[model samples]
Target: MSFTIYLRCFNGIVLREALRFVHQKERFFSALVRPLVWLGIFAAGFRSVLGVSIIPPYETYIPYEVYIAPGLIAMIQLFNGMQSSLSMVYDREMGSMKTMLVSPIPRWFLLISKLLAGVFVSILQVYAFLVIASLWDIIPPISGYITILPALIISGLMLGSLGMFLSSAIKQLENFAGVMNFVIFPMFFASSALYPLWKIEETSEWLYYVCFYNPFTYAVESIRFSLYSQINIEYSIGIVIFTFIFLFLSILGYDPGRGNLQKKGGK
Candidate 1:
């Protein structure tokens, strides 16, 4: 297809996703609410109990709420990714996915376009959350507001790709809710989102390793650093690597000839 056609296709997908997001007020509200509850209530109650020492990107001891802010931001992207995946499953059931897949435009491009559309929605949700958090005096550096965009995009794509990958394996729309809970909770709780890896290490070495290797942990850390106008090269690189891995797998999963779709006789 011509480059103009590709551009038009991308714009169409993004516009449709944006309109869907605008109509789904509850989805946007809930995305903000989940993190806000953790920040306003959970963080306040645990502020005294949880102490964060100076770590990279953090020059001194910080409040629990401030520390978990990046994690919560990552959580937004994580949930958005899964929500996009759920939409893919729903589209498949309704025959829209098949229609789109059969289009002359490349399948991989279509999937990536859909993934970027979800990321676009997620970036908006995250910034809204940050604005609300700032009102509560949990602001990051002023420059961070601008600097964190790249990190947000990378993390969003990685998490969204994960959702796409998961969706390819899920056959039924109803089963996806269970699969999402199964994946989301463990990835969130087991990572450094809520606690420092060192603290987890002190409590349990194995759990610490899990946290160290978890891709979500890297996503959180990368955001944490970027929010401070700093960079964690290692974790940033990790996020990119994980993004490619998950995206490649997702493409394979959607392939009609050689992937999961073939096993199901081109579902």
Candidate 2:
């Protein structure tokens, strides 16, 4: 009975998110544009200069655009997460969050449903980006597409949970746009998303450690490995750990008894 209720709640939340996505047509293209622009501009500039090592799983030398494609895929998920988090902030301000909190479901279940909804929306945007990349001749192995599905879901949920936790932590903020700017860009750029960890390490030891420690790096590397039909064991484990940590933080922050949500002037 509890499982049934949870399933129904999950379905309803995903449906609502899907409907919202259908209405926001601009968001679809906007998600696509951001990465493509980065890919186009960076690939054009760095194609000749950056030498990609013969990394395991990636059999041969690949073009710069192809190398960054997984990162861009992860990028779309990261931005989608921030947007979803912003929506949560808006919901709280509008009093809708109160209604959600008052529901019969467990708060953790609600959080999971919310995370899944965001993941679903983000995955749709990801495939659209992939389709465009393929059209641009940045194709992957056809099997890679099949294998990437699970990777996308795991990566999407990790990023979405991080955003959700961030929203809950800053529940008092009248404007959460700053979180979007401050959180998203740093996580994206500081990771293995754009450049190899080795390359970044060569430039700065501290920065390499930053990238290594960044959960986003694991998320991106996990996706990159999946794209080539290989599993990055260490990074994959890192993503799971980070996801659970963020999930626990999210649950705590939204708990009014323990968290800032119901406290006046709390951060």
* lDDT tens digits by residue: candidate 1, 4-81: 999999999999999999999999999999999999999999889988898888888888898999999999999999
Each model's number of backbone clashes? Answer: 0, 0
Residue 57 of model 2, lDDT score? 68
Each model's C-alpha lDDT? Answer: 0.93, 0.86
TM-score of each: 0.97, 0.95
Residue 8's C-alpha lDDT in candidate 1?
98
The ten-residue window of minimal lDDT in model 2 covers 258-267
Q: Among these predicted structures, which one has the highest lDDT?
A: 1
Question: Which candidate leads in TM-score?
Answer: 1
Q: In model 1, what is the error at residue 171, expressed in angstroms?
A: 1.9
